[model samples]
Each structure stands twice: as structure tokens, then as C-alpha cells.
Target: MLGTLAAVPVGERPELLAEPVAKAVAGLPGILVAEIDPELADTAAFCEAYASPPEFSANCVVVSGKREGQVRFAACLVLATTRADVNGVVKRRLDVRKASFAPMDLAVELTGMEYGGITPLGLPADWPLLVAPEVAAAEAVVIGSGIRGSKLAVPGALLAGLPGAEVVENLAR
Candidate 1:
């Protein structure tokens, strides 16, 4: 389903992918990485310019909150068609008080991925990957390649099967 773009096999991913994402997905089957113009990296722009539908685009958001007086983080993935249930579902799932979007600086610093390109693949080891059910079911979804210069097309199963990934119902609203 990803034949629309100029993509390389996952094993041949370029350096544009963050070190962690590249390392994690190396040799993984059913993952394709496509280099894109940084100017069209945002979801809407990328979709329109690349002929990918919104339903097949996954947005990765970083959420943070405090649990037991210590900060906790999670990478929440939801289809572009919906929004992550951050205040309700995500906060409850993370078992934290007052969960909110992570500050851009912190997100970039911690994920080692550029803004607009944070992906669950290379998230902090301790951080959980909260995936929306739809995203986990799509045959193929476009996601960040850890940088604004490229994107990744991955099978839903591959994303849901990532270490610490949890596909939750109603995770998106």
C-alpha cells in the first residue's frame, strides 16, 4: 500500500531516522522509510503532497505527568482522523495526575527526535507507547522517521508489537 512514494526498505533506512528509531526497526520486515521534503513534514502537508490519506497517517504525541512525585512520560499514537484522548484516557492509562502535552524542548531533548517528527520507535526506554486501536489495526500507517526530512510507513502489527506498546480502545477521541 505504500508504493506511492520513493521509499527504501526498512533495513536500508537512512541516517535521517533518529539513532534509536533506526536501531529499533533495523531489519524489521514491513517497514518502509521514505525521505521527504522537510517543508512538507507536518501531517496535513505530508499527506496532501505524498498522496497518503489521513486515515493512514499516525500522529505521535508526547504526554507527561507526575506519578509518586516523579515525572513520567508516554508516547501516544493516534490516527490523524482522531485526537488522542489525552486528558481522560491517556491520564488514566498512565496513572498520573494532570497529564499534559510535553514541552517541545523536553520532547525533543528526551526523544532525540526533531519537533514534528517524534516517533514511538525511539522513545525513552522507560516511556510507554500508548497506541490507539485504529492505528494498531491499519495495514499500513505513515509515521515520523525521527526527523522532519523523512517518514516511515509501518504495518499496524509492527507498531503495536513494539516493546512496551499497548493498544488501547478509546485511546483517541
Candidate 2:
């Protein structure tokens, strides 16, 4: 069932879904939720097991930086084929003197989601959601559904339009 995109009441209210993912899917149109095995949570395993194309999978990374003794966070989303421009583009865009990936513990604590399942959908309102232009241009993208037990299939434009989301060029390379 990994690759089969099962039918799980992903209606206006995805009741069977987890809290963080359900909250997000309930609000967004044209989004589907698929329950998956936690053991196959990582992108590579999930994709291979589910027959998903790596091209359609997006990874959400938590980036952090400090300026004036303040730490800031942002969620950078790029396709599996590329990596986020963390030190260069991210640092400059965040306007932080320096930027680096957030610590695993901090990311988990702040997002209130599993370490590998932190999604842009329910991140802090203050944190920016930086989406690569290519990702926004895709028909749909597969992203963590707030937990390792599932993934959210959502339209790229919808993701780009999320409250804190911004389409940025050179986000990934």
C-alpha cells in the first residue's frame, strides 16, 4: 500500500489523519493524505516502496541562523533531486549573519512533529516557508504529512500560496 495512494477520508475534514497533517489538509483544497508505514518514512524508502517518482517528492529542511544574539528559523523545501542553498541563498535571504540547518532536537521540539516528518504545513507562523520555483511549478508535490506514518499530496501552487510560503529562485541547486 505504500505506493497505492489509499483512500482515507481526506475530505474537508480528514478525521482519520494525524493532528498536524489533518489540520493542514482540512484547510487546503486538492490535497490528499496517504497513510504509510513508519519504517518507510524516509524519502528514498518511501519512494521505492510506494513506486513514487523521486521527482515529485519534496524535502522540508529546517534552517536556523543568528543575528544580534537572536536565533531565527525557516523551512526550506526543495525536490529530492536537488539540495537547498543553505549557506548562500538561505543566509542572504534570511538576512542572518550566518545560517545552518537547525539541530534535530530543536526542529522536533519547535515543530511538534517527528524528526523526519516536520512539514511546512504546521510550522511556526513566524518561520518562513521558502519553496523553490521548480517545486512551485510542479503539478503536485509529495511532502511529509506532519508525521512519518503518512504523506500529503498537494498542488504545488497551493503550497506556494501557504500563508508563510514564498517562491524563491536559487533556493535549490
Give the Cα lDDT of each candidate: 0.88, 0.83
lDDT of 1 by residue, 1-173 (tens): 34368887867756868888888887788888898899999999888888888888999999999999999889999998899988899999889978999999999999888999988887888889999989888898999988999999899988999989999999999
Q: How accurate is candidate 1 locally (lDDT)?
A: 0.88
User: Runs in model 2 with CA error above 4 Å?
Assistant: 7-9, 12-18
lDDT of 2 by residue, 81-170 (tens): 899999999999888988999999999888878877777787888999999999899898888877788787878898899989999999
Model 1 lDDT-worst window of ten: 1-10
Which prediction has the highest lDDT against the true structure? 1
Clashing pairs in 2: 3-50
Candidate No. with top TM-score: 1
Score every model by TM-score. 0.95, 0.92
TM-score of 1: 0.95
